[model samples]
Target: MSSKFKKRLKQLHGSREKRRRQSTQDEQSRVFTADDVEEQDLGIATSAVDAWRDHGADSRPTARGEAHFLVRHHPQSHQHGTKRLAEGAAVTLEGFRKQLNDARLHSADPSRLVFLDLETNGLSKTSFPFCIGIGVWEGSQFGVYHYFTPTEADEPASLSACAEILRDCEGLCTFNGSSFDVRMLQRRFSHYGIEHPLDDLAHLDLLHLARKLLPDRNGHKLSQLEEDVLGFGRTDDVPGAKIPGRWKQYLKTGSPHLLLDVFDHNRLDILSMVVLLPALAEGLGSSSDSARFKNRASKSDLGNRPSSSGSDQQARPPKAKPKTKLASQLSRTYALRKKAQSGGRRQPETRPTEQARQEDVPRETVKLAGSFSRAKLRRGMPIGTRLRELRGEVERLEREGRGDEERDEIVHRLHEMVALSPRNPFALERLVDYYRGTGDAALADHFAKRLDETSPF
Candidate 1:
């Protein structure tokens, strides 16, 4: 009986091993089939030389007989997502300078400003830029140009071409060029013993502007801004981290198939900057003008108000005006406050007119979480006001049983609310529940820990 039992256990073990081997074989076959499908879809080119030509890029020869890939797009015919490339020509640099409050851009010419973006292998000083995309406004048309180096030897020619394109431009506009792109390009030019064209240009880095304008935004990445501000969303764009590997693959296999997406990525970046500038300018202008108008109105009200007391009416002492910017602003604020307090008693509180009441009525309730205006939150409302509004919205959404439909956006609102007021247990509990519901164990743990730390005994 013991022998029979041992035999049965051995047979079970053997069957399990056999099934594992079969599953491994099946997985290997599936992997091979997926690879085959991918290869077939790529339509792999035969040689590097032919691959580039087939990729719709023309080659231009240099002094060392090396050539770089060149792809050009005419703004007259090219439309990047929803924005017409030609609309970039309509933007004025003077307006941008005034709106952005940058005196450096006072002399920046719109036609001479080049929109620049670079794709690099890595961030290290030793690493290099493989692709440079630039957009230039020429008359009524915007020109998009991409310079790609096929090999290390061809880098000089590509850099030279990029320099030539930028040499005539007076100003440079980039998303984060000040930190990465400009520095990288300068280092590359130094490495190649060539004169960098960026030295003389008036640089306008949009990253800083975006941060100032969209302060409440989660991130200021170009892709994020494209979605939030420009209403353009990228579909199936290659991840940036995977791009360097694709280039290495192209070098090894003589295929431009993968680099095709990289090229599109670079093009969209340049075009997005072109589309982003006007939007930035408009937003900045409106905000600045509104604040200025409010300040002026407050000062006017303070000035027109009658004296509150006999001493104020006498005005015997002549006071020196504030000399510093901060002092002047503070003085105005103090005067406004005094005027407000004095006038409150003088003017009787009257019932709201029909038009006033109608205006105060809550706006048509938006069903989706996406309708929450980030800009409105960023407009300098009191923290308590923002918290109340956010909490009220969350409560309303809960009452309506939004469930998974607006999960991500609801989470976003909670995050912003929590960021503004961390002590609030409501936001913390909701976040913990959200992460748990979404099966994000790490985030759930984090929020759970936070909830415990903040919980009252």
Candidate 2:
């Protein structure tokens, strides 16, 4: 057989074996609670966990556990709280205030606000949320609330638990909840015949706020807000698109590990809102405060400058330079690289010229591609299209004798594409070509080996 054909066959075999092993392991290790057995004996498949395990083995553990745990744990707990946020502890008004206050002071919000983030199945009108996350500011502390679709026969009950928490809040905040999260929740409620309380709450969406406040900003993602304003970072959080797969994994295997990561990611999103609320408040509030202060200082300087023969103007503080063009370029590049990595793309080398135009790449395009590459790839568009575009642009530049200016752009784009679409043959081939063209035979061969290994007949 040809090497490519052999490799493809081997991959298929390995995939089959992996699936079989996972199935066997799931069946053997499945957690069988008395409740599940009771439901089964009654001829009712009420638990999503049991139903999932019956169908697909090798499911994620945390999601299964999350569903199972929610059902097993009573919705009402008498331990130090009034109502269950999700079958556990009630978040008191005092606690909420304290958390809100902390976020406000630390992040410097004049209004002392909170931000919310959520992940759902799709962006389509028909899409519904299987998971929800909320970020709230309480006093001086920041807290998060997350809910996953319950595994019990009563999915509505799980949603009710989430709705109850939201009802108690004086204000609701989210990044794009108005357009995405809220609407999805509303649809789910409608589907289940449940009532949604968010309609009455004081809702604040950061998406609108971000655009209004930072009109020149390239993107308005929560992660971008975190990096640009809050100066925070993250790593290895599962992409939102992988959430469904993780949920499926839990259903099959009854393992909670992958689900925990999802929960953590959701929690981080909630916390990011907490960070963002204050930062945004500060930016808006402090701007006027700063202007007033500057105007007063300027008037004083003007009066003194004339009387003192311009000595006061000279003595006054020098105007702070706007972040240098170079610095701005670097920041933009860093932000893009960071975003690419978060979305499961590779980080590229920071070439100086590429850094200059980093802002030119539409943030939405990058996000759309990163978040929906699986569907895109299924449609026969390789995940490396963006990288290809960049390489093509660079090649064109090189042909025009703008080699130095274009080289950095080429390298950066290649790096990001390779990082995102590590499995793409085109990206690997280009990397091989790039190294070969640049006289890095060793690196070229390294990529060549990877290409050969992953290539299908």
Per-residue lDDT of 1-457 in model 1, one digit per residue for the tens?
Answer: 6999999999999999999999999988874568787776445322455667766777666543445666665645566555666556566677657645677678777667889999888778798988888888776677677777766656888888777777787789999998999999999988888776687777878898777755544467888667555668789999888988888887787666767789889888888888777666655556776454333222322433444343344322323455875455345434432432353234212223445456675333322223335576688767788788878867876777775534544565676566666557898798788768756676677667767978776
Best by TM-score: 1
lDDT of 2 by residue, 1-457 (tens): 8999999999999999999999999999998999988877555334444553443322223211333221111122211111122211122223223333423233233223334455555567755555556554444344555555534343555466556556655566677778777787787778877776767665666677667656554456766555545556678978777887777676576555557678778776665554455455443445676344333323422333443334434333333568965466445444544543454434433323343347676433443223223575688876457556655655665687635435544555655555555555765676688779867676677678868978876
In model 2, which range of ten residues has the least summed lDDT? 71-80
What candidate 2 gets wrong by more than 4 Å, as runs, is 1-38, 41-116, 123-127, 135-143, 150-152, 286-457
Q: TM-scores, in order shown?
A: 0.51, 0.44
Evaluate all candidate structures by whole-model CA lDDT and list the values in order: 0.69, 0.54
* Cα lDDT, model 1, residue 299: 31
Question: Candidate 2: TM-score?
Answer: 0.44
